[model samples]
Target chain A: MNMPVSQEKKKIFVTVGTTQFDELVTRVLHPDMLEIMEAQGYTHLIIQIGRGPEPQIPTSQRIQITVYHLKESISSDIKDASLVISHAGAGSCLEVLHAHKPLIVVVNQKLMGNHQLELAEKLHSERHVVMCYPETLKTTMTVFNTSSLENLPINNQMALSNYIEKLMGF
Target chain B: MGSGGHTGEMVRLLSTLDFRHFSPRLYLVARTDDMSAKRVQQLESSHISTAGLFQTVSISRSREVHQSWITTIVSFLQSTLECLRILFYYQPDLILCNGPGTCVPPCIIALLLRVLWIKRSTVIFIESICRVNTLSLTGKLMVCFLADRSIVQWPELHAKYPQTVFLGRLV
Candidate 1:
């Protein structure tokens, strides 16, 4: 049977940057979760698994899956993504937010101090990214819409430049 | 700088610099952290006009994640000595750091140099953007005495500290 013409290629990119969160990789690939994504009209799932074991993909019917360990840079992948699911590292979160993509930040609760949770929660309050634990990722995905989110402030990264210039008397 | 988020943020911050004025830059990473060295190189080649305008120096991490307190003393002293050597050799005009354990020793050395009227290397420390409600241990130390200019990314931190400059998302 021919696929419906209305079905377009929508890719969901899941990244755990520079650190392994095996639980996220496992949870997102669970058949139930795949069905959720399929129901939501996503056609592809690309995962960047950082220092983790290669994920086992169940024999699939509809959605396509791709996995890789790392990349020199992930900005291109992020740019191509329809929605991004990322670990709650500041680097990954900032990259996605700066790209203005809809994001779901999965907090790695196993880590000590849980500063990642703090960052995710703060962003969630601002409606910039949705925050969920690995255990809740399925439910979060089932309800998540890639349509609406707030914009981050136009990057003030240049402010640091001016401050450094002033300090150095340049 | 340390690896992971620390290096990522520092690289982003450094990329904002006008390399013409800040040429001959020095990046100090944990001696074992090859990843950060690679990142610094990437940032330099992409952002700077010339190669060899920047140099990277490797030093031991003053405190590693989950390191025990007893061994921390030894590692901290070792890193402190290394930072002293590096600073004395370079006597750089400015020292910029974020909240990595590797940064503490250099900040201390910079403060000592300033207090002794030997070198006036202005030290600036930025708290990680992750710190929303509370400061990291290194952040508290910088606020207490180390930094000449302390910056925080979140407005809540500035409201709590009052002393830190809130510049709103520096990296």
Candidate 2:
């Protein structure tokens, strides 16, 4: 008689939001990073490449990998993810934080305005997310700890509605 | 509403509204943005109570990313004319927009209409949550003269610009 072993599936979802961040995409798809992610016990890797170049898979990887260009909404992906590694876009960060999942925000310095850097740094300082530059992404991933993360409060949607109603005299 | 970030936040904000009170919502999208239209449909359909109460209109983009200054003037003027036509026809009671380059022309037109005794449409501008320390170009331009009320999601921005109201992360 043999005992059945239950296998757990852990997924890491990487998103670059609507804008292209080729550096973050390329760095995440590197074989070395794949090895690191696998070693960290992530059984599945999903990448939302956005407008970046298509990913090419290396033949020798044991973990499962899925890549797609874009989606109407990434809420389901964020829900399924055990960990989310995303670009420092405000929308993506807020969505992940709203889900109360562990998040690693990788800043794209090549972006023209570079407002993402400030946003990411602020969130990191507040301990809501782990912020790192694309160059340091690998190191950050290797040392990432989910228990250190904190969830941001759900926003009061009524506040804006009430204010607008009062201003509009409704 | 303009780019994906702006559209996403606006949709989330509007989802909280009482559609019956704020009926006939008009969403102005940038000509270059196709995603926002689909998002609008999703938002409308999800709330069956507000079906057919809101619609989206496409306006020329005021400026494209990395556009040169000289060509920006031409596009800006083109968009301003389009906004003028739209606002003249609708004359909405309230115009709500977050910071996006596409919002600038419409807000300016709304302000012009109110000043000229044409029709009063209150314009509200909400700064993007991404702006932590400083204001975006659109925020700077609208804070003083364009918007009837300017709101910021971050205390830092509200403190720096006393003109902006802090609603504590509306988006």
Candidate 3:
């Protein structure tokens, strides 16, 4: 008899667009770990998907990357991803969660010089997106092999009701 | 301050300034056609005067429009006429313009009708985004341009326009 492989099958997709916030989080993920990620048969990896800003660092060949600006353009890609990493801007988070994809969100503090940190923290507390702050990023990525979108918080029914309330009042 | 950086920050700064020493009537103009101004009003309801023109038109012949010369001509005429009506009525002591292209005509009127009753009526042009880059472009022509003081959110603007003063980020 054989044991199941230690790593779960993985498909990862990343996005940081619509706001200039991605630069901070994008700085951290090194291009080297695709071996550890790929060896375990983590099937796919998608990174840095946004059109506005170009990457400051070089990219890794182990994973695929797409810089998508419009929400409609990202549908099939998110469906193919197991985990979605992104900046904590409201619009991007809505798109990730709309697909019921697992998420790790990083907010951009340097660009607009405003309250994106607060917005990120609020999302993490609400269980909508996992916080990818400076310290937690490493642990979060290592565990990426095991994580599944099924366990992460994605409440379309609840989100739709909340979105409707926000719309009706406006 | 209606919902953006320059306008939002300016409202807070004005609250702290010694306005008690000088009488100033600050009117927050809204473009009924624009959403940013509406969000701004919601953010700072207590701080600004809500009355101003409700119509707005863009500074484009058309974006992604294959053909619209007829529509563009009609909008240009309508915007010009409405602006004339606003300038004659508001006569604000100080015009603080944080924009949408809607502010253009009223501001042009403010400069054109310089009254001797006041040594100078203060008009401040505030820029946060590059939506209408016209304000920066105009500094080349007028010695003391559209607004008596031009306030920009980006510090880089100060270097570009010697007349501009940089205000810190709008929340």
Candidate 4:
């Protein structure tokens, strides 16, 4: 079943967390990729660029794309988004998951350690998110479709709360 | 809280606390760490009915990635003083933190308070799930002496640090 027109018009939020993922940002902003997103019915794209230098975004009268430098709060943006394309930062992943949005995690291999890839692999194995390498982002987005987003398991808050209660000896 | 991944893990762990029992919780974050503070506020508003139940204070960050030792030392001293002041005023019964350089000062100060018989706040240090094979620098420091209870997400780490409890992944 197709989503209602209003729901389909919801923006896609692309965030790199506090660090820059220039490669991912570049792929996302590519005219061809943006066209695919536009075809998918995303009317607007909101990107949190973090420390990455601003990419030359192609002008599209059809889809409105806004770039933010580094936001202290992107919760509202996350909430408003139908899909989230984020870096493999656990913070960004968790926030996207908690919001119950469809997520695509792009790992930055240039990081000091390959830890981000480890996390991406784990989450991908769990079917919690789709994982893509930074270099392969364009190909991933080219084939991107909404049906790829499986329904996430319930938020981990209740289980975490229960555990904390037990730990606190309550 | 530090920033990025550590803050995310900390937020998930904090979400599980029975806030009714742990009333008036205080969150200590780095002075420039807007991300952590925003996250804590969001979590509280979503879960808890009480408006003022969660309070946040910004303290100095102990170090930055790839920063020099001299910069780290200066930041650590400043953060340590801030931690002492916050602990003295708030006087929380239990202090819970995850792996982050920012967490070190508070954990150390809490230990000092307990040793000096000033205040006996239990410090619980949870190693981040990202540390699959080994503990982070902050985790190594706290797991040995400062933290009353040190928890690890991965069993391999638990084997390495037998004393630290292994609970499954919180995130």
Q: lDDT winner among the candidates?
A: 1
Q: Can you write out model 3's per-residue Cα lDDT over A71-125, one digit (the tens) per residue?
A: 5246676778876777765445655666777788765555543444554565566
Scored by TM-score, the top model is 2
Please tell me which predicted candidate would have the highest DockQ against the true structure.
1
Q: Can you give the lDDT of residue A20 in candidate 1?
A: 90
Q: What is the TM-score of candidate 2?
A: 0.96
Q: Which stretches of candidate 2 lie over 4 Å from their true place?
A: A1-6
Chain B, candidate 4: TM-score? 0.94
In the range A50-168, model 1's lDDT, one tens digit per residue, is 99999898886499999999999899889988899999999999999999999999999898988888789999998999999999999998888766579787768689989889878
DockQ of each: 0.81, 0.77, 0.04, 0.35
Ranking by TM-score: 2, 1, 4, 3
Worst 10 residues of 2 chain A by lDDT: A51-60
Per-residue lDDT tens digits of candidate 4, residues B22-116?
A: 88889888887887788887888876545346689999888878879998899899999998999988888888888788888888888888889
Ranking by lDDT: 1, 2, 4, 3
Candidate 4: residue B14 lDDT (0-100): 70
Q: Residue by residue across B16-119, what tens digits does model 2's lDDT show?
A: 88787877889899887889888888888886368446778998898999999999999999999999999999999998888888999998898889889999
Q: Which portion of correct inter-chain contacts appears in model 1?
A: 0.90
What is the Cα-based lDDT of residue A22 in candidate 2?
A: 84
lDDT of 3 at B91: 58
What lDDT score belongs to each candidate, Candidate 1 first?
A: 0.89, 0.88, 0.49, 0.80
Model 1 chain A: lowest-lDDT 10 consecutive positions: A146-155
In the predicted model 4, the residue pairs found to clash are A161-B16
* Model 3 per-residue lDDT tens digits across residues B94-136: 6555543444555666666665342234566656333112333
